[model samples]
Target chain A: MMRIEDILMTLRMFQDENCDVRTVTLGINLMDCADSDLATTCRKLQEKIRRLAGDLVQEGTLVAEEYGIPIVNFRLAITPVAWWAADYGVDGLVRVARALDQVAQEVGVDFVGGFSARVEKGATRADNALIAAIPEALASTERVCGSVNVASTRAGINMDALLAVSRSILDLARRTADTDGFGCAKLVVFANMPDDNPFMAGAVHGGGEPECVINVGVSGPGVVKRAVERLRAGSPDLNLGDLAEEIKCTAYRVTRIGELIGTALAQRLRVPFGIVDLSLAPTPRIGDSVGEILQMMGIGRVGAAGSTAALALLTDAVKKGGAFASSSVGGLSGAFIPVSEDAVLAEAAARGDLPVDKLEAMTSICSVGLDMVCIPGDTSAETLAGVMADECAIGVMNHKTTACRLIPVPGKGPGERAVFGGLFGEAPVQPVRSGGEDFIRFGGRIPAPIHGLRN
Target chain B: MSDNSQDFIIAVMAKDRPGIIAAITQTVFELGGNVTELSQTVMGGYFTLILRATLPAERKESVIKQHLEEDWPDLALAACVRRYSPERLFEPELDTAAYFLTIQGEDRPGLIALITRYLAERQINIEDLYTRTEGDAITLILQIHPQNRQSAEHLRADLQNFGERQGIAIHLLHRDILRATSEVGAIRRMVRQGGCLS
Candidate 1:
C-alpha cells in the first residue's frame, strides 16, 4: 500500500490544483496522401486522417477516466500541408483545410493543426499560397489551426516571408473581429519550431517522424504555485534555491503523470509513442496561472524588475525536473506565460504593469514569445512584422524555440477590452508604440549569426 | 531464505511492551525453525502479530502454544498456530485497480459502521486502513479494491452521495498515481509494464 500522505498530495494536485494532461495530440503523417489533383489529395488526406484518428477521442476518454486524470483536449497534427501541395493554389489549400476540419469534427477532436508553411529560407509558390489561404481557412473552420515558421538558427530570419505573414495575421484577425479577432489566436509565427509540439496553434507533424505518433502536453502551474506557497508557510528561512527545488520536484511528479497517460494511450492505439511536452500551459482559471507561480516566487509585479530572472529560473528548473522524469521529453519543454490565457498575466497587462517590451524580455527566457497578446486594430502590417522580427531574433540568436501569436482586435484600441471568451479569455488591447516603417519596408533577410554556423 | 515443506502459521497477541518479538523468536528458535513472513499491528495498547515459520520437522499447534505459555511466565499472551498452506492464501485485494479513499468528518457514533456498510454494499474490499483523531480532527485513510471497473464506477457515484448526505469531505484517487509520485522506479511499472505495483 502507498503512503497516505503521498496519496493525499496527489489527490490535492488533481482535486484543487487543476493538474491535468493539457493535450494528447495524435500526429498523422499525410505525405502519402498527396496527389496531382487537389480534390483527390484532399479526399485521400481526409480518409487517412479519419482512419487513423477515429478512435483517438474515445480511447483518450477511456484512459482519462481510468487514471482519474482529466485529458483536456484531444487534438490532431499532420504533416505541414505546403510540403506536398506545391502546385495547389490558395483556393485549393483552403479546400484542403476544410477537409481536415471536417474530419477532425467527425472524429470529435478539439482542434486540427498543420495548415501551415515553413519558409525559414524563402517562400515557394505553395508556401505563399498556404499563407494566403490561412485567413479564409481558419475563419471558415472552427477547429483548424495554422502556423508559419519564418526564422531558424541556421537559416536566419526571412523578413520578406514574415511581411507576408504579418499581412495574413491582420486579415485573419479582421475576419474574426466579432470574436475579438480569435482567428489570429489560432495562428502562430515561430522560429526554430519543434516538429512534435502538442500545443496549438503551433503543433505540426513535421519531417523526420513516424507514420503515426502520440505526443502529450502536461501542465500544472497551479500545483507548483500551491507548492511554493506551502513551502513559504512551512519555512521561516526558505531561500530561492529551496523554492526552485520544490518546483523541480513538483514538475517531476506531474511529468510522470503525463508520460504514464501518453504511453498507455499510444500502446492502446498501437502507434509509436513520441514525446511529452512538459510546458506549463495555463488556462484562464485563477489558480492555474504561471504568473501566480512567479508571484509566489517573490516577483511583486509580473513585469517588474526581476521578471526575466524569475522566468529563467522557472523554465530551467522545470526542464531539469521533467527531463529526469521522462527520457522521451521533447518539444518546447518550458514554462509558458501566455497573456490572457493566464489570469494574472492578463490582469497585469490590463493594468499596464506588463508592457509588450517587458513581455518580450521575459519571453527570451520562457517557452513561447508574445503569446496571446492583443494589439490595437490599426497596428500596421509593417509594425506587426517588426514585432515578430524582434522576437524571432531572440530565438535565432539563443537557439531556442520561440513563437509569436499576436491578435489585432479590429476596432479595439489601448485601454479597451477584447474578449475572446472561453480558453482564449479577454484582455485589453495592449498599446504598441509603433514605428520602424522604413526599416521594416526594406525587407530582405537577417543573415545567420556567427555562432549559428555550428555545422 | 529457506523454503521448507513443514511450515506453520502462528498468531500472538499481548500487551504493548518491548521484548515481545524477542520472546516469540526465541521460542521459534528452540523449535529449530526460521520465521519466513510476518505482519504486526497494535491498537489501544494491545499488540497482535501473525507470522509464518518453516521447521525441519512438523510440530503440533498445541505444543508451540503451550511452550510459549510456560516459557514466558511474566508476560500474559494469547496464541494460535496452524499448518501453513500456499493454496489457502487469503488475498484481500480483488483482481482490479486499487484506489485510495480518504474521509474527513466529525466524530460521531456509527460512522465506521456506516462507512463499512457503504463499502459492503458496493462489494469493495479494504486492503488496508488506518484512522487517527487529534484534537477533534479525524483522518481516515482507506485503501480499497473493487472487483472490477463497473463496480469501481458505481463506488464513485456512491461515494459522492455518501459525502454529500453525511456532510463529509472525501477524495478518491487511484493507488498507482500515488506510487508514480512517491517511488522513482514505480512509474515504469505503471507505464511500460501496464499496471503493476513494483
Candidate 2:
C-alpha cells in the first residue's frame, strides 16, 4: 500500500513543481517506403506515417490522462530521408518535406523530425542535396524539422558539411524573417547524434531502431530545484555531495514516471517501447529552468564563476539517477540549458551576464550544445560555421552528443529582443565575436582525434 | 466440533494500549489458533484490529469470545468473531490501473457525500479513502480505480468541473508515480520485475 504522505508528495510535484512528460514521440521508420519515383516515395511515406502514427496524439492523450501527468508534446520521428532518397534533388526533398508536414498535421503531432542527413564523415550526393534543401524545406513547412549530423568521435568533424549547414541556417532565417527567424528554430546541427532521442529539433529514428517505437522524454527541473530548496531548509549544513544525492533521487522518480507512462502507452499502441530520455528539458515557464536548478545549488546567478561545475554536477547526477531507474536509458540524458526556452538563461543572456562563450563552455558538461541561442542578424555564415565547428569539436573530443539551433533573427542586432513566442520563448540577441572567417574558410574535414582510433 | 481446522475472522476494539496485541495473540495461541493475517490502526483514543486466524475444528467461535471477555475483563476489550470462509482468503487480482485523488476545501457538510456520489455514479471504485479535518479546512485522500471501460480523460474533466462548482481543489495522479516518488526502492523492484504493484 502506498502511504498517504507519498501520494500527496507526488501530487504536489505535479501541481506545483511542474513535473511533466516533455514529449511522447512515435518514431516511424520510412526506409521501407522509399521508391525510385520521388512522388511515389513521398506518397508511400505519408501513407506509412499516417497508418503508423495516426493514433499517436489520441493515445498519448489517453496515457497522459491515465497517469495524470501532462504530456506536453506528441511528436513523430522517421528515419533520415537522405539515405533512402538519394535520387531526389532539392526540389523533390522539399516536396517530401511538405508531405511530412501535412502528415504531421493529419496525425496531430507537433513536429516531425528526420528531414535529416548524417554527414559526419562525408556528404554523399543525397546528403549534399538534403543539406541544400534544408532552408527551403523548413521554411515552407510548419511542422517539419531538419537535422544534420556533421561530426562524430569515430568519424571526425565534417567542416565542409558544417559550412553548408551554417549557410542553410542563415537562408532559413532570412526566409522566416517575419517570425524572428523561427525557421531556424526548427533546424539543428548535431555531432554524434543519438539514434533514440525523442526531443526536437534533433530527434531522429535511427536505422537500427524497430519499424515503429515509442520514446519518451521526461522533464522536471522545477521539481529538482524545489527538492533542493526543501533539503536545504531542513538541513542547512548539508554539503554538495548531500545535495547531489538529493538531485539524483529526484531524477530517479522523474524518470520512473516517464518509464511507467511510456511502457503503458507502448503496450496500448502495440509498438515496441524504446527508451526514456531523462533530460531536464525546461520550457519558458518561470519555475521550470535548468538555470534555476543551478541557482538552487548555490550559484548566485546562472553563468556565474561556478556555473560549469554546477552544471557538470547536475548532468552527472541526473544521468546516474536515470541509469539506476531504467534499464533502457538512451538519448541525451542530462540537463538542457536552451537560452530562449529557459527564462532564467534568457534573462542572463539579456543582462549580458551570460555570453555566447560561457553558454558554449557550460554545454561541455551539460546536454546538447548552443541550443535555442539567438545571435545577431549580421553574424556572418563563416562565423556561424565557426560556432558550429567549436561546439562540434567539443562533442567529438568528449564522445558526447552536441547540437546547435542558433537563430540569427533578420533585422535584429545585439541588445534587441527576438520573440519566437510559446516554448521557443524570446531572448535578446547575443553578440558573436568574429574573426574566425579564415578558420571556417578552410572547409575540409578535421581528422578524428587519436583517442577515437580505439579499434 | 469437526476434524478439519476452522478459520475465524476476528475483530478487536479497545482504548489505545500497548499490550492489546500481546494479550489478544496470547489468548488465541492458548486456544490453539494460528494467526494468518492481521491489520490494526488507532483512531482518536481507541484501537481497532481485524485478524484471520485458524483454530482446531474442536473449538467454537463462542468459546474464543467467552475466553477473551472473561480473561481480559479488566482491559475492557470488545471482540467480534465470525467464521472465515475459504472463498474470502484470496483477493481477486486488480488488473486496472490505480490513481490517487486528493481533495481539499473549507470544512462543510455534504462534501464527502458530493464526492462519493460523483464517483459512485460513474462506477469508479474507491479502494481506500481517508479524510481529516483541521479547523475550517478538510482534506480527503482516496485511492481510486477507474472502471475498465471508463475514460480517464472524461472522468478528470468531470471531476475538475465538479470541483469548480463545489469550491474544492482536486488533484488526481497515478498510484505508481506516488510509489516511485515516496518509496523509490519499491518502484525499482516493480520495474525490474516487469510487474505492476497493486
Candidate 3:
C-alpha cells in the first residue's frame, strides 16, 4: 500500500504544479501505400492513414479521462514520404502532402509528420524534388509537417543538402509572409533525428519502426520548478548538487506517469508500445518555462555567464532520472529550450538577455537546437545555412540529436514581435550577425569528425 | 478457548508499551496457538492488535480472555477471541479501480455528511478517508472505488456543481497517477505485472 503522504504529494503536484503528458503520437509506417500511379498512391495513402489513425484521438481522450491527466495533443508520424515518392515529381509530392493534410483533419490529429527525406550522406533525385516542393506544400497544407536530415555522426554533414534546405526555408517564409512566416514553423531541419520521437514537426516513423506503435512525450517543467523552490525554501543552505537531486527525483516521478499512461493506451489500442520521451518540453503557459528552471537554479537570467553549465546539469539530471524510471526511454530525452514555446525564454529573448549565439551554445548540452527561434526578414539564406551548419556540427561531434526550427518573419526586423499564437507561441525577432555568405556558398560535405571513426 | 484444533481470531488492546506485543504473543503461544496473521498499531497512547491463530480445538474464547486479563492486570489489557471460519479467511479480489478525491474549505457543520451522501447516492464506495482541521480550515482526503465504469467527466461536473453550491474546492484524480508519481517501487511492480489495475 502507498503511504497517504505520497498520495497527497502527487495530488499537490497535479493540482498546483503543471504536470501532464504532452503528447501521444501514433507512428504508422506508410511505405506500403506507394504505387506506380500518383492518384492511386494518394488515394491509398489517405485511406490507410485514416483507417489506422481513425480511433487515435478518441482513444487518447478515453485514456486521458481515465487517468485524469490531460493529454495535450494527439499526432501521427508516418514513414518518410520522399522514399515512397522517389519516382514521383515535385507535383506528385505536393499531391501526397495535400492528401496527408486531408487525412489528418479527418482523423483529428494536430499534426502529421514524415513529409521528409533523409539526405545526410547524399540527396537522391526524389529527395531533391521533395525539397523543391517544400515551400508550396507547406504553405498549402494546414497540418502536414516536414523535416530533412542533413547530417549525422557517421556521414558527417551534407553541406549541399544544408544549403538547399536553407533556401527552401527562405522560400517558405516568403510564401507565408502574411502570418509572419508561419510556414517555416511547420518545418524542421535535423542532424541524427530520432525515428520514434512523438513530438513534431520532427517526429517520423523511421524505416526501422514497426507497422504501428504508440510513442509518448512527457513534460513537466513546472513540477521541477516548484520542487526546486520548495527545496530552497525548506533548506536555505542547500547547494546546486542538492537542487539537481530534487530535479532528478521529480523527473523520475514524471517519467513513470508517462510510461504508465502510454502503456495503458497502447494496450487499449492493441498497438505495440514504443518509447517514452522524457523531454521537459515547456508550453507558453506561465510557470511552465524551462528557462525559469535555470533562473531558479540561481542564474539571474537565462543567457548569463553560467547559463550553459546550468542547462547541462539540468539536461543530464533529467536523462539520468528518466533512464532509471523507464527501460524504454528514447527520442530526445532531455531538456528542450524552444524560445517562443517557453514564456520565460521568450521574455529573455525580447529583453536581449538571451541572444541567438547563447542559445546555440546552450544547444550543445540540451535536446533540440535553436528551436522556435525567429530572425530578421532580410537575413540571407547563406546566414541561415551557416546557423544550421553550426548546430549540426555540435550534434555530429557530440553524437547527439540536434535540430533547427527557425522562422524568418518576412519584412520584420529585430525588436519586432511575431505572434504565431497557440502552442507555437510568439517571439521577438533576435538579431543575427551577417558576413557568412562566402562560407555558406562554399557548399560541399563537411567530412565526418575524428570521433565518427570509432567504429 | 475452543478445541485445540480450531482456528481463532483475536483482538488485543492496552496502554501502549514496548513489551505489550511480547507478553500478548507469549500468552497465545502458551495456549498452543499457531499465529497466522497479525497487525498492530499505536494510536492516542493506546496499542491495538488483531491476529488470527490456530489453537487447540477445546480452548474456549472465555478461557483465553480470562488468561490475558489475569496475566496483564497491571497493564489493564483487553482481549477478544472468537472461532475463525473459512469464510473469514476469504478476501475480495481488488478488481475495482481506485481514485483519490480531496476537498478543502472552511470548517462547517455537516460537511462530511453532505459529501459522503453524494458519493453514496452515486454508488461510489469509500475505501478510506482522513480528515484534519487546522484553525478554521478543514481538509478531507478520500479514497474511493466506483461500482461500475463511470464516466469521469460526469463525475467531475457533478462534483464541481456540488463544490460551487457548498462553497468548497474539490479535486478528484485516478489513484494510478498518484502511485506513479509517489512510489517508484510500486510502479515497477505494477508494470512488471503487466497492468496498472492494482
In order of DockQ, best first, we have: 3, 1, 2
Q: After superposition, how far is residue A444 of candidate 3 from its true place, in Å?
A: 1.4
TM-score of chain A of 2: 0.99
True contacts kept of each: 0.53, 0.45, 0.57
Regions more than 4 Å wrong, model 1: B1-4, B42-46, B88-95, B186-188, B195-198
Provide chain B's TM-score, model 2: 0.81
Q: Summarize candidate 3's per-residue lDDT along A1-455 as a digit string, tens digits.
A: 45766776787777888888899999999888999999999999889888888998998888887787889889999999998988889888999999999999999998999999999999999999999999999999999999999999989999999999999999999999999999999999999989999999999999789999999999999999998988998998988899889999989998999898888888778888899999999989988889889989999888989999999999999999998888989989999999999999999999999999999999999998999999998988889999999999999999999999999999999999999998889999999888888987888899998889986
Cα error, residue B123 of model 3, in Å, equals 3.8
Please provide TM-scores, in order, for all candidate models, with all chains considered together. 0.95, 0.95, 0.94
Tens digit of per-residue lDDT, candidate 1, span A99-204: 9999999999989999999999999999999999999999999999999999999999999999999999999989998898999999999999999999999999
The collision pairs in model 1 are: none
Give the DockQ (2 decimals) of all models.
Answer: 0.49, 0.44, 0.51
Indicate which candidate wins on TM-score.
Answer: 1
Candidate 3 local lDDT, residue B57: 88
Model 1's CAPRI class is acceptable
